[model samples]
Target: MKICHVNLASGYHGGENQTLQLIKQQAALGYELTVVANPKSPFVAAVRALPCRVVLANHYFAAHAASVTADCDLVHVHEGRAIYWALIQKLRHGVPYIVTRRIDNPLKKKWLANIAYRKASAVVGLSRDIVAKIQHAYPQLSPYKIPSSPVTYPIDETEVNDIRSRFKHRFLVIHAANMLQHKGFDVTIAAAKALQEQNANVHFALLGDGKAREQLETLAAGLTNVTFCGKQSNMGSWFAAADLQVHPSYTEGLGSVILEGLNSGLPVIASRTGGIPDIIDDHVSGLLIEPGDSQGLATAIMTVQANPQLRETLCAGAQQKLTSFRIEHTAELYQKIYQEVKSSL
Candidate 1:
């Protein structure tokens, strides 16, 4: 089957990474695939290295619509802008398309989103929360909830060991998100400060770069225990070296990094928002704190650090949870969705 994946963003993030993985896995299964993105996009370069065709075009809806509709059998769009373009292609060339809704933001732009939803043949929501939002915002569309396949990034076990050896016995905590206000990095910093005030010898690692980097650095000033590692290509080492993964985001469709950390055998301490509750059972696999609660976060950290057995228990439970999100299992589900769409066509 000929499939076209469309994303308008120029940067690489969880959604782009997940799309890349799907394309790679599908290509291995002998499906014809093409990617539509900006010419200078990192996604374009990344997809180019794969065994699929890459079509870089300007943001003009007409240009992209014409190009994609003429050759692709199915268009799998990643976001709102891509959905709009796909809608145009469908109207002009009768091309069927699917959309993946990846965010759990409030649906304040309902009218605009509903228009695109009505045109899509199927809507793929990354989480149950996202699906509910679509249903509430545009009930006419009846979007299906297809959990985003768990993300898998290449990691070297030997490298993980090397990193862990250097940070020996240090209570290391990592927050692997782009420095952003919504990501709640400041809350994490506050929690770290609270721990430090109690004379705890803990280290916090920030593993991404974004607009809030400078601000976060300033907030982390005078804290020798905090290290902003910027963006690392091999983040698995940080995951392996860390005692806990902290994700205090205000909103998320699904925290893929949390899953990655769990897969690496580290327990998560995240806000109880979006599909986080779906991934983590509070006090089981990980601890859940309310969004923006620095005190709650500090208490959880102290509890986890003080009880070694609790940490081991959480790690074991997290490993067990990893079974449900295995990459191969999610790939099979997507394959089934493709077959279903193909047979209907």
Candidate 2:
């Protein structure tokens, strides 16, 4: 089947990465694929080598007029702005489209937005939390649940060794995400400071860069335990060298990094918030703490650090949880949805 995937996100993030994974998997299955993206989106570069056409659409208007899906059997909308583009295609040309909602945030309660969602062949959410939000915002709609999957990147052992060398004899805790306000960087910093006061032999390597870096850095000033490593390209190496991964987001659609950490055989301690509980079973797979609780975060960190058997158990549980979230399984589920939607159309 031929498919046109539309994602007009301004920058590449977790959602874009998931789109890339789906496109790659479908391409392997011999499906002709086309991607409609903003001209500056890093998603364009990421799929350039793949067996698919990448069309540039500066805005939703361009996306609608650009004949992106003339030869495609179906459209997959990966971002919000692209919904209208797909809706237009369906109305004007009878092109069936599927909307994949990735965030737990509620949709706008506007008439046009509601119509756009209602017109889709199917609506997919990355987690039950996201599906519930969509249903709450649009009671007439029933969104299907299709989750994001764990990613495994190639690891250079030398790079891994280099990272471990920098923080010798310290129990390293890695927190990787854009330093956005909702991501709870402030909570991680507070926990790091608390750990420092206790003279704990633990360190935090904060990964990724965003608008909140300066503010977070200021908050972490004079704390020797926290190091902000901005946007490293070799994430697999960093995951390899870290003792634990912490995701303290106050709210998350689904923590893709947590999946990656689990795939890397790393134990995780994350907050009990949106979509996180779906991925982790507290005390079974990984530990969970209340969002923005620095004291709780610090105590959880030390709990894992003090108990080697618990770490082993968590890692073992993490591996078990990962089996259900493999990219291959996610891709096959998407293909089934595509077939069902297309047949109904």
lDDT of 2 by residue, 289-315 (tens): 999999999999999999999999999
Candidate 2: misplaced stretches above 4 Å? 65-67
Worst 10 residues of 1 by lDDT: 60-69
Candidate 2 at residue 299, lDDT? 95
Residue 125's lDDT within candidate 1 is 77
* Residue pairs with clashing backbones, model 1: none
Residue 82 of model 2 has an lDDT of 94
Residue-level lDDT tens digits of model 1 in 9-43:
87788888888878888888787888888775689
Predictions in order: lDDT:
0.81, 0.90
Give all TM-scores, in the order shown: 0.91, 0.97
